[model samples]
Target: MSELKTKPTLMEPKTFIDGLSDEKKRNDADALLTIMSDITQQKPTMWGDSLIGFGQYKYQYASGRKGEWFRVGFSPRKQNITLYIMNGFSQYQHLLERLGKHKTGKSCLYINKLSDIDVDVLKQMIALSFQARFDSEI
Candidate 1:
């Protein structure tokens, strides 16, 4: 089997955030780091070159694809701040409705800036995603 390319690294999260070229994106990333850290009660870790991951869990697919991944995370992409919501979005319609301006993929929540969203809702979503991973393991 091929190896996972996005494993955790020893790269410092703050250093990575500090190096972002866009000032607004860097500030948004900092806010996200604080919020996710508070919610997960874990220091963020660098996942590969970009993602700032909070906590981790092991996952195995029916097709035998398996790996460890973050419970919740985000990246300051050039176009948007992408949040890794680990659990898919099917269960959080209410929260999403109130999340303000954002987009999503299979497990990503994309936002242009922190000021555009209701941060409290974002925190709840992150906390829910973080807890769900542990809850499933029990």
Candidate 2:
């Protein structure tokens, strides 16, 4: 069976964040690090080359494919800050409504400008989602 492509690596999450070429992205990453760390009370780790992750969980698909993945994480991508909200956002619509300019996939929250979002609302969403995933509350 094919393995999961993005697994935890030895690279330091902060170093990766520091190496980002865009100043705004770098600053936004720092803010994200702080928010996620404060909520999870866990140090962030690098997942593959460009994704910073925190905590972890294991899951198996119906077909028996299984892997470990971060409980929550983000990637400062070229297009936007991509947040992996593992518990998904259905239960967080009220928070998303107040979150300012952003977009979402099934599990990814894409933010172009950190200044455009309500950080407190974002923090709440992160905390609730992390708790849901980490504690299996969902």
Candidate 3:
């Protein structure tokens, strides 16, 4: 089996966020780190240099490919802030409608800035996604 490319790293998350050249993106990344940490009650960790991950889970696909992944996370990309919902977003259309300006790709939700979305709704979405990780364990 091939290895997972985006495994967690010992790299400090705040240092990574602080190194971003874009000040706005840096601030947003910090905000996301706080939000995710608060929701998962877990400290953020650097995943593959860019991703700031919260809690973790072990997943084994039907094909027998098994790996560990963050329960919920986000990356401050050049174009937008990409949030990993982990469990995909199809079941959250109702919440998405109220999410304001954003785009989705599979389990990722992209937003240009936090001001572009309702933070409370985003928190709810993250909470639900975070809860789903534990739910699947049971």
Candidates ranked by lDDT, best first?
3, 1, 2
Number of clashing pairs per prediction, in order: 0, 0, 0
**Taking the tens digit of each residue's C-alpha lDDT, what string does model 1 give over 32-116?**
9999998999989999999999878887666677788889999999999999998879999999999999999999999999999
Backbone clash pairs for candidate 2 read none
Q: Which digits, one per residue and each the tens of the lDDT, describe model 2 over residues 11-127?
A: 999999999999999999998999899999989999999998888888877677878888899999999999999988888998999999999999999999789999999988888
The C-alpha RMSD of each candidate to the native structure, in angstroms, is 1.7, 2.1, 1.6
lDDT of 1 at 89: 91
Model 3 TM-score relative to the real fold: 0.95
Predicted structure 2, TM vs. truth = 0.94
Per-candidate TM equals 0.94, 0.94, 0.95
Per-model lDDT: 0.90, 0.90, 0.91
- Highest lDDT: give the candidate number: 3
Which is better, 1 or 3, measured by lDDT? 3
Cα lDDT over the full model 3: 0.91
Worst 10 residues of 3 by lDDT: 129-138
| Runs off by more than 4 Å, candidate 2 | 133-138
